[model samples]
Target: MHEKKYLILYSTQEGQTYKIAQYMAQELGESHCNLINLHEAHTVDFGLYHTLIIGASIRYGRFNKKLYRFIDRHLAQLNAADAYFYSVNLTARKEGKDTPEGSVYIQTFLKKSPWKPKKIGVFAGALLYPRYSWFDRMMIQLIMRMTKGETDTSKEVEYTNWEKVTQFTKSIEKSL
Candidate 1:
């Protein structure tokens, strides 16, 4: 039996989305999935893969512009494949905001995008205050505070649900 090839591509700001893509690729098996950073990929032949899992992190309430451009350019190829899209953001860490339908950023992106994937995921991102610049830290801190999230600038807090990620991957495997 031939296993379908899969691409796990990510556009990350603080590395959470990249880490999620890498972990999903590892769990799904290295032979079945190829993990790539969207920025460095430069060129991707969508026809090479049977399934596409695209992930992007939200920075200042917006996804990477390159992500939007890629989707626009390869919408047909991506739609032909069994495509999945996941959004990573601190906003998903809030109560009642964990699902794709519940996430403001995800809803906004999906409404604007022409490519609608087979499955959508919303993952809670991390708060790496130590890695942020002063301006970003302050901005993020204010946002978090408003959302009732962790506000401490000295500690890094991870809010991702790995079990949920594993389940999502298992579902993707089943799709093949």
Candidate 2:
């Protein structure tokens, strides 16, 4: 079999998205993948990769601005490749289908961009209260209370389901 080329590109605020990208890349294997942070990736030659996975974390109900810009800059190349997008947010773990806000996020991006990824995954994000500032921590705590999510500020909390992430990655692999 010929070697496969995959690119896992991601942007992270507090590292959750980065971790997920790393996990996906590791599962995909070193030889087949090139995992890069959006900030570090200046010029991406999309033609060099057969598959591309882009991931970004949501903060205050919006995907990372840098990731969006990066995608916008390379929209044509992305659309030409086998591409997938994963949005990491706390709302994914909530007990409903895509919330109005989440739906808006996806729709807004789709409307603004030329690229329509082959697959879109929304994974639950983490609440790293310990890493937040006092004001942010309190605000997030209040948001958590309103959302009925964990509000514990004493420790870090991860809402990501690794098994689901694994399954999602495998699905991408199968598609490729």
Candidate 3:
């Protein structure tokens, strides 16, 4: 295969999506990859990249509105290339919910999105009490309580599976 150029664009609310994108870039070798915040990356020409990976975190039953707008704007370019999309949500932390089919948020987004990526991933997200604002912290705590999750405000839990992340990257690499 010829040398490939990749773009890893992410929209992060609490930073998990950005961290995932960073790791993907590292695994892909930074030399041929560019990492950009989706909100600020609208001006970049997507046609120039041979591979595109978009990562976004879901909150309040929705993927970031900014990311939706970006996808809408670049639907054709994204569909034209080898595009992959990953969604980070705490719901994926539960057993049997890590895959795209099992993730309700992923399913919802897929139904709503105009651009369907060739690859889809669903990863667990983080709960950083300190990082959240007062209202967010309270709301999240309530959610955790309702969901029978960790509600200790002082604790930080990251449910992401690093091994799964590695596997996903390898799958992308195989295609390239």
Candidate 4:
């Protein structure tokens, strides 16, 4: 029997979403899943894959505009397929804000688009101080302080919970 093909595509700014996509692809295995960055992929033949997992990182409380446009442009094909969408953001790492805020973000995006993915995930993002510009770094630091998140800007921090990500992926696999 031929193995089913899955496409894991993501849009990342500071590389956290990319890392999560990589982890999902790795866990799903290269033989069954092909991981691609939205920036690197010019065209996607939706009919060629059995399932598609689209991911995007949140910046300024919204998803990447490019990702939103891609989904909007390919809504028909994506809706016809076994599709899943995951949104990653710093708020998703917070104790009480992750699920609700993530849901709101997804719902707002879906309201503007036509496609409704079968599964949705909200994963925690990271704070890469080293990767941010001086202005962004200071702004994020201030936001973190306001939100009672990690205040020390001297070190890079990752707030993602790998176990939750793995469990979510496994659930999707089973459903498929």
- Give candidate 3's total backbone clashes: 0
lDDT of each: 0.88, 0.84, 0.89, 0.84
Please, what are the lDDT tens digits per residue for candidate 4 over residues 1-176?
Answer: 65788899999999899899989888888788888998777789887788899889988778878887787778788878999988898877866556634466777877876778887888888988878899988999898888788877777889998998898789788986
TM-score of each: 0.95, 0.91, 0.96, 0.93
Q: Name the regions of candidate 3 deviating beyond 4 angstroms.
A: none
Better of 3 and 4 by lDDT: 3
Backbone clashes, candidate 4: 0
Candidate 1 wrongly placed segments (more than 4 Å)? none
Quote the RMSD, in angstroms, for model 1.
Answer: 1.1
Error of 4 at 170 (Å): 0.5
Candidate 2 residue 142 Cα shift, in angstroms, is 1.7
Clashing pairs for predicted structure model 4, backbone only:
none
* Residue ranges of candidate 2 with Cα displaced over 4 Å: 97-104
64-167: candidate 1 lDDT, tens digit per residue:
89998888888788878889989899878776788888999988998989989899888898999999999999999999889788889998999998887888
TM-score of 2: 0.91
